[model samples]
Target chain A: MAALKDIIARDYGTPAVVIDLDIVTHNIARLQAACEARGLENRPHIKTHKSPELAAMQREAGAAGITCQKLGEAEIMADAGFDDILISYNLIGEEKIARLAALIPRARIIVAADNPVAVDAYAEAAKRAGKPLEVIIECDTGRKRAGVESVADAIALAERIKASPQLRFAGFMLYNPEDAVAQTQAFLDEALAGIRGLGLEASIISTGGTPNLSNLGRIRGTTEHRAGTYIFNDRMMLACGAAELADCALHVYTTVVSRAGPERGILDAGSKTLTSDIGGLDGHGLIREFPQARIARFAEEHGFLDLSASSRKPAIGDVVRVIPNHVCVVVNMVDRLIAVRGDEVVGEIPVAARGRIV
Target chain B: MAALKDIIARDYGTPAVVIDLDIVTHNIARLQAACEARGLENRPHIKTHKSPELAAMQREAGAAGITCQKLGEAEIMADAGFDDILISYNLIGEEKIARLAALIPRARIIVAADNPVAVDAYAEAAKRAGKPLEVIIECDTGRKRAGVESVADAIALAERIKASPQLRFAGFMLYNPEDAVAQTQAFLDEALAGIRGLGLEASIISTGGTPNLSNLGRIRGTTEHRAGTYIFNDRMMLACGAAELADCALHVYTTVVSRAGPERGILDAGSKTLTSDIGGLDGHGLIREFPQARIARFAEEHGFLDLSASSRKPAIGDVVRVIPNHVCVVVNMVDRLIAVRGDEVVGEIPVAARGRIV
Candidate 1:
């Protein structure tokens, strides 16, 4: 039986996530340098690669800590000796709270809470654990996914965190502001002012998104930035003008299994490997070898590539590399990623937190 | 240090794939009974559950064999003692061909080929293995995803398979016909006539799709039926009138992480857990508790639920069971599925072929 490692070593199969380590290193250095030049702490989100090795590389490149979307991810990073971790998602449920409390002693764990109910739950769990858990109040700066709506609401949540004996108020964390610099800065300034007016100190102000990473310096009050996809720029990032095609470090290696017609072919990579996130792009992913070919549709294990527009169409049994529309979700879909450097296989990194949805 | 097992055991986490065993049994029995009544061979596609235990149940319930989409899945099922297996996708590339050829000795393995290139590859591998491989020519019956274009094309491919030194032409396999019954029957009849006219024996005519299972009897030439999603019907199946809400065996157990606003809430389940396959449906999925609520949008780890249509809204920390837009992909996303019977935790089934995209 050929394991994933053997298959990757021999370049034996398709539908595998391949990461170029050199490109990854360059991407990390570029982002870290950008943040350092602006005097901002770069706490890169580990949700993209989810590898301890990659997270360690980021930390070595001067990242303050790591950011995770779930406690499961944070636990994996914490186990890997990442001392400072920020879970940017709303921490709800007793089970999750207990898990968060357990991580308090092992690492400098910080969690986000958008409401007082979440704040109270965190306080209760921390009190039970006999430890003080750092709480970051999530604020809505136009991204309506999660977070307190207004400055007053953010101040109220911050105050509740400050009032709790077991919870330490650790400033704010917003997902990704719609309007980058001015509006995000205004919202942060107002919320900070409101919190200070309540006689509490707001320390850390964190914001993230690869598209807005360049504008992090423009946002005046943010102390740290958390961008996951910057490590492995994708088609979405390229389309958003965040990175060029040359900056994409990870690519899905796939084989054209069937050429149904002159205009259409099917690749082994599908929604399972490449993901269905178009990210407002025209197609599912970008074929590096065949730039004009569009990933028209996807079955569970079949990516339908439209080769009508391409001057050079690949035959059945030919291999191609696809850059996914969204790299983070694609990373979450696979178990391991093969890391390469200029055609030579360096090593393989297990996506430690691949399916850590909890 | 809570593992997935511990989390599932305590029912402590959200965004878990919960399988109702009773419903699974019923679904298996119902589909088998239908096929039995119509004298059609039930080769249930194992791509849905991908569990050896469930496959055994299906086989015991009178499934003639099992169907898989990848060589990896075939190897797993073959290891689990399933002797008769049909891999529906075209087997290309040396590695996959070698794997398929290896399965030939262990199981009565059959593979599909839409073109001569794949047929030649299969023949080469089977010849190298010194085994006669059963080869089925995939026919295009309207779904242009795979298979040969016309009846003549399918017959040509079948002739190519018959002429191979180590291949046995096993007849045709058509993807779910867009227009069932009349079109399917016509397509099958024409393809059969063409192959017979070439003095080749066309033994097995296999056709499959969950939507066309009820009309399988109407397609006169089809000897076998392959359906995957009928085991755990999804929202797409319900919308296509394939199954009812009560028939859906699987549900995504998710927690309301944040009530973003009065009319909006976020669930822990997102594209990572539930998939972005809307399948021509309106929303991402259907929340069983709040039938009127629409899963409006999804970030990688967050599902935005629009509660504006619902009279009752769930608060943060509340659990909601969601029937995903597509269950097959959802099953492929998770590592293990928690099986339950009337609120009692029966057991857990590891998704043996979860990431078997290769």
Candidate 2:
């Protein structure tokens, strides 16, 4: 089989997600080393790559386990022989609960929940399945997206889990904080204090974000770090000083299909491939070959690149690699990642959990 | 099999794309009737639904053919027994050309190109396959995304196609214009004048956009209107006054997974499900039940719904139907669409060409 680099030069198609395996290996090693140096358990989130094969690479690099955002993703990872998994989303519905329960017997399944309804449902499902599920109380440190608003709510949920025979109070999980060390330490200190007051010991404390991965030691109470995007850094990571441009492992190989104007051109990849994730950036993504060119706009199947800033413009049929704004969402958009090592197609890693949105 | 409406009310999973077959049938009939009344052919673009079953429904509704944005999509449509297929994209590379060549024998494959390089490649591929490929000169009407800038350039490409033995000059293709009728008429008139001046005939003049579908008749010299989103009108269409909310056929069923605050809750659907296609709207999507609510932001798998404006807020696990800003990109995000009709799941339609980006 032609290496991915050769495939791109030869028979490879445009608008395809190509992963640099060498970079991925280096990324995994670097992040793992950082966590190890901090004495933090590195549970890399598989939601970034969504590939069990890549997860195995993380595991080989000394990751304690893996993290997933959904039960469907956890199921995919579990089926691929990953025994320890943490589903970081509050899973609801009987179908999802039943699926979660099914995974408890096969893997060391840990789930996060903030509300009583989800906690009750998870307890019931675990009881019905005759398996004790490890439950994590998700606390909202600053990011108002999900999790309990206060440490009291986190303690309350942890107490409820401690009181349940089917659910075990494992730890607390929080995401995306400006000051991870200070915010997470405060949240964990209060929650842990409350848990200790209730005669309970918290087994784990997790805080994760690629932007804060290197500063895990400063997060006083965090025992495990669950950073996902660090494994395949993107423009967002680069912007946040989490990773350099060279640390980005994935790139969408696209062909310039039409030069609409001297300063404008269209690529085969668009919203469907590169995605609409601005990631707090100005444009859609960065064109590696034409750094000055801006991916100004995207239709579903066409990426409009503004080449006016470039001294030399590319002609039609020229292939350009784009580093997406958010690599995780971009990874989930495609079916498989074409793994390449120095212009050689090393392997084809199927995105095992690409659209497992349940 | 139960109807989709019943499925949504009962066993359907949240964050799944549900298409009401009744609305789809009605939307298809309504648009087809409008095109028929104007004596224009309606070739609905399959890029929105990406399902053969839906395309068959379109064919049953008297569609002239189907429109695909990618050759991979055209190949899928061709395999499903659709003969007249127009791939409105610049076909490039030996791999893509070979695939396009393979589809030529199976379907009446018509492709668009704005540059001579693409036209020459298509002609060469057609010659190698011993099949005459229908070539369309794409003109940039107003959407500065793709297509030749001027009528002279369009005629020049048309002339090249007319002179080629392997390539057939079929028509002119353009996409999304602010003033579709006036702009398309002017472009078509000039291109037609230029083609006639060169002693040639412009067989087909195709223009399409859901926003301008109603004004197809006013665009003189165009034989077919290729509106895709009319079959599943979205918030963009609703805003454009092209179609009412009643005409919308697709809805994403999502569950409230977290109630972060009194006026804020997170839905299970986010960028991965609903997509980041704001369609020039303020938010990500429109929640049908909570029209006053704003889909403020999106994480990869979580949609933050602002319930501050809504009189009533939903609790966790409550399913709400969200009509995406752009349905085409949302359709591409999922693996399957739950087909429902009047509260019953009629069937599960696989998104056959979901990730056929090549």
Quantify all predictions' global Cα lDDT against the true fold.
0.85, 0.86
For TM-score, the strongest prediction is 2
TM-score of each predicted structure versus truth: 0.96, 0.97
Interface RMSD for candidate 1 relative to the native interface? 1.9
Off by over 4 Å in 1: A1-10, A178-180, B1-10
lDDT of 1 by residue, B59-171 (tens): 99999999998888999999999999999988877777677767788989899999888999889879877889888988776677888877778878888887888999898
Candidate 2 TM-score, C-alpha based = 0.97
Write one digit per residue (lDDT tens) for candidate 2, span A109-171.
Answer: 888998988898789879878989988988887789899998878877887888899998888
State the TM-score of the second chain for every model: 0.96, 0.96
Off by over 4 Å in 2: A1-6, B1-10
TM-score of chain A of 1: 0.96
